[model samples]
Target chain A: MAHPQPPESDPQSPSAPTAPAKSPRVGLFVTCLVDMFRPSIGFATLKLLEDAGCTVVVPAAQTCCGQPAFNSGDNKDTRAIATQVIEAFEGLDYVVAPSGSCAGMIREHYPELFADDPAMAQRAQHVAKRTYELTSFLVDVLGVTKVDAAMAGTVTYHDSCSGLRELEVKVQPRRLLAGVSGLSLTELPGAEVCCGFGGTFCVKYPEISDKMVTNKAEEIVATGADTLLAGDLGCLLNMAGKLKRLGAETKVRHVAEVLAGMTDTPAIGDPAASLPNKER
Target chain B: MQSTSRNFKDNAHKALNDATLQRALLNVKSGFQENRARTVAGLPEFERLRDAGRDIKNHVLANLDFYLERFEENVTANGGHVHWCRTPAEAREKILEICKRREAKTVTKGKSMVAEEIGLNDYLEENGVEPIETDLGEYIIQLRHEPPSHIIAPAIHVTREQIAVDFRREHSDLDPNRRLEEPRDFTDEARAKLRDKYFAADVGITGANFLIAETGSTVIVTNEGNGDMTQLLGKAHVVIASLEKIVPTLEDASTILRLLARSATGQEMSVYTSFSTGPRRSEDRDGPEEFHVVLLDNGRSAMLGTEFQDMLRCIRCAACMNHCPVYEAVGGHAYGWVYPGPMGSVLTPSLIGVEEAGHLPNASTFCGRCESVCPMRIPLPKMMRHYRQREFEKGLSPQKARAGLSVWSYVATRPKLYRLATRLASGLLGRLGKVKGRLTTLPLAGGWTSVRDMPAPEGKTFHDLYRDRQAAKGGRE
Candidate 1:
């Protein structure tokens, strides 16, 4: 029942201490999805963190955040993976991930995974206290009000379920997106609803998953936005795939890519038929 | 009643394909979800009220034996007979015995999920006693000989056109060309048909929303006044409820009532909140001559100390289902049980064996929306996961899925091996998808590729790329 306390040097406080002599060391958790499907998100996260005056480290020992195992009722393996992640990201000021889904798995569910073991539970809590979703780390912890980023397009943002519900990452992403020049944000209808890419759930119940993502795709296309952005790769992939299957032209990318002004790469699910086009 | 829960996948497939059901399911979002959101926003204390409601249920559950005993004593003292039935069969037989004692030919019922849980109507028909459903939604589904789909809105899956067709087919004595285009028109017709049945019935059965342990009063909240007429007009009144329905006091019942209406139908209060104490008094003008309360255990007692005990706090509001995307997509019937949606996913597996209803728990995205909107703060997804854990432990999960998970875990546990495997897989997939940037087909991923393409990886793992970046920077700083 103990509440996790915020770090001592509260950046948002009016009387907050000035920048410390040493830069805050950040351990970037390159989520498995971002690591495999789109390493650009990982690079974008690195740029965002480094630009915010922090020293960033990519911990190679970390792979998945143990979410796939945790959600599948395989707690034994989840524990093993979580232990590896904890050991890998030890001694960092913050463990930031480009994904709310993976960050939430570490921040929220890790402690719960080790509830029965007090020793490991303490370690999990320590790691959890330092873990944060990327946008939240930028806006909330770093007091980032604006970003030196620009992207041209009317864009809509889908609030991934874990980020919005689990970590309260609704406004932090939007707070940063509002600062991006030349970007008009059209709010997605039912933005807080899940995109149905529930890790393995999409395949387990593909029919149901299709219906949900199909509805999401319709709403995204209805916005007439040229691009779609979300914080988590899982949801972006799901929506992007469905949008492609339906032959819709709305591009998809991780929110970090747009926030870091890193949209030079082709949008997710877009064919590599055309050369990379920089929006700015 | 009869569980097709074992065939949940097939049921969900059928539900997904049924266009009419799909269209009707849309109303759940605009109707219940939006209304509840607006209503809860208007009331600032709704969250605190939820907390209060949860604490009260937790307290009552902790002393469930004491409260239930007190409830029975109060009911007996109020000139009411309390029947303690351990199983659904016992509860059904007890009600049938009371009906036979009165020599009842027909009985009218108000909306009671417990009745549906016990399959009262089918049992009554087999015993030569006709059970007439008086609630509009209940009556419609009953006429079709179909079980209720959504709990609060029993016939929610049925469109107006379907209901009109059903009415014409069943009520052959009525005019075949009656206009039932409007909701009021359907309700008016149903009212007229059910009016006489209320007075003609020898026994009336109603589900108690809350059984006050303090006063022995059985409370029911209904938009329609049929519950009042059914209980008062019959010669004998029987209240069928589960043991968990007992609350410590009337005040506690009122606190839960504040949440039930807003959560269930977005009303500040139900139009009719009736509380019946025992039967008729000696000086009472018009009421049932005899009163009986049947408390069925039906696996609820076993749940008291288990992980699913929070399920007992459910007030049958259906808020969880209203906000659930999975439930929204497939509708209620696909859950293939008496109770459906998120609550049903947890409760069904517990009430029925988990072996029979394993699919119910597994068929969720775990979006956490159900738990977010739940009035009782039930950790529905957590409980569902617990059911999954049980299935895994019991080897009830599919062998293929288990094998796949094992292979995934085996590699995932070894960071070096995981890196190598993901690097190779991403490299192959990225190469295959070089042209389109996505793969339309892949081996062992037919479920995914059947409806949508799989976006290819960026050809290299982040670990590999980051390591190279570090090497270019001349080692770790």
Candidate 2:
């Protein structure tokens, strides 16, 4: 498979209005963790894309991408999950997810997940090529840095592990945030480190998970940002929980919700009341 | 030989307190990681090569005995002796016998991890042989009476300032007033000291990177060319290599070498790639008169057909160690074994027994950086989990941790009970927060609460929230 010219450099970003537009249909793959807990991330994803001049569609048939079961050595459940996901977004113009962990499941892992079946491997490869994380698609494919959506607040971005390592989703979100008027992007130290939210890993090894997220929260607080922004809701929720428990004055917001200017309500928490406590 | 792991806690205490060593380790740690990343990023097909490399290693490991015998035949046909040892005792005996037969007083050696495994240097010294480590990094550790902190860069825990002091004490003949500030100065001083040992030593010892079965060639990759000098000029040459070092063909060796150097020093290839087929070939201009290959099984063959067979595929690129966050925080010496980092976490337990190195596997956050950057693509974090599983199965886990896990397992298996327990736990913890939403103490989770306030759960568990949301959305629409 050829490496896609990143959406930022593609002819699509600047001249997307004049260029012949391909099918605008996008199948939003609401990842299992997000679907079960943070449904607002799904709606924010829809609003962000539709606002960016794309015809967004949520394939309700989508279920978990089967990464959890697959990585845990349960091939039976993984295949069951993969079969459900493949059927959900089969023949779509593009399959997009708000989570890099899930997109990596579809893009990098799905083919390996079905190596025993040649037909499924081919189908997985196709899906892997078209699938993009929301920010990668927004800045790279849609070529829109600013969503014409604006919010006045200091926000620090957490680079999710899968998104940063697997999909290189660091700069695209940063680029889009830089273009947003009145949005101050505060850089968090050791931003590339994992937030200890490895799906089931949080519950499986909660002690270590708590240590990692607590470290991440301390870094987020050090930035003195009012809100913590990240591409993946899994990390945001984990960070948010820690932030809330510490009574940290900072709110946790998804990059999509910020880019879409939908930060008025508490999707995760209230942004205005966020203040760093000395106890932290 | 010696169980350094038994002295781990004391060694770790010393390692933790030695500010000078810590300073040196911090400087060298990220340098290697950065170089490796830059090198791998240059090769577009590096990841594909990694997969292929892993497959090749898997294939070789599955047919190890056949490959070992084939390698032995090839080495013997090319005028080299092949001695196989099933245990460390046999390996030590064979090497000592060879050294005694040569009547060697001094032995110059290249960097060999396997030698360290067998405790060859200490054994040689005890048997009236003075072993001189020719590798600059190895030589530094020898002077300090310390084992290597890193596999490739021995004495990586020592900085240049410490090296200057070591050189001044070890080589008192050198100009005392001479200022040595640059890396080049240290390299040159070590080289000048070791060059005489290379020529005067009766025996030369080095490690084999790969034993080519088809060519009977023992390949060694090094930056300093010290291994070549040790083997080429010495009267008797001994290659102390592990059983897993054999490859079926030179092509396979090249494939592994391509990834090895790139993964290691981030070079497309190391400065020197030497292939020695046999006793320097009779007609060769410069070579050893007698060549011996001491193949040590040392519990490696037991790994065959086991869950750890993939571990044998490790080319010792040190990528896993370089990328590991835990390894960065507590340097390799803290691991309390010959190998360190993610690979060491899995390997030391298997080779040295889990009871000895059980804490090594637990010393991880399961961050998965090691797996991502691994050139051989070893699923290191998952493998660590397998060791953790073994600890639990063998009842080796601490009673407190075991009880904690038992309770967790019970809760994890029952969703309704789990939710009820979590709800009550979070609610109680939430209400106990003092001083504007912070809990300074907790009974059960004091390990967490001691360091940072345990995050209160967001009122409802995901399961509870989902149930309510589904009901509100008209029974899932």
lDDT of each: 0.90, 0.75
Q: After superposition, how far is residue B193 of candidate 1 from its true place, in Å?
A: 0.5
The C-alpha TM-scores of every prediction are 0.97, 0.77
Best by lDDT: 1
Candidate 2 lDDT, A148-249, residue by residue in tens: 667777889888887877788889989878867788988998788778666655554455456567768888999999888898876776787677767778
Clash statistics: count for each candidate: 0, 5
Best by DockQ: 1
Fnat value of model 1: 0.77
- Output the worst ten-in-a-row residue range by lDDT, candidate 2 chain A: A1-10
RMSD (Cα, Å) for all candidates, in order, is 3.4, 7.1
Candidate 1: chain B TM-score against the reference chain B: 0.99
Quote the positional error of residue A207 for candidate 2 in Å: 12
User: Fnat of the models, one by one?
Assistant: 0.77, 0.04
lDDT, residue B338, candidate 2? 87
lDDT (10s digit) by residue, model 2, range B1-477: 355664554555566557786677676446877788788889899888988888888888878878888988888888899998988779889998998999999999988998988889999999999999988889989999988878888877888888899899989798998888888998888888888888899999999899998988898999999989988878988999998888889999999999999888888899999988789665788888898999998888887877787888888878888766556545788788789888998889879888898777766656678888888888887677667667766877668655654555444344456557765655564455422334555676554444344333334333445456658977642
Q: List the residue pairs that clash in candidate 2.
A: A7-A140, A8-A140, A13-A143, A249-A274, A249-A275
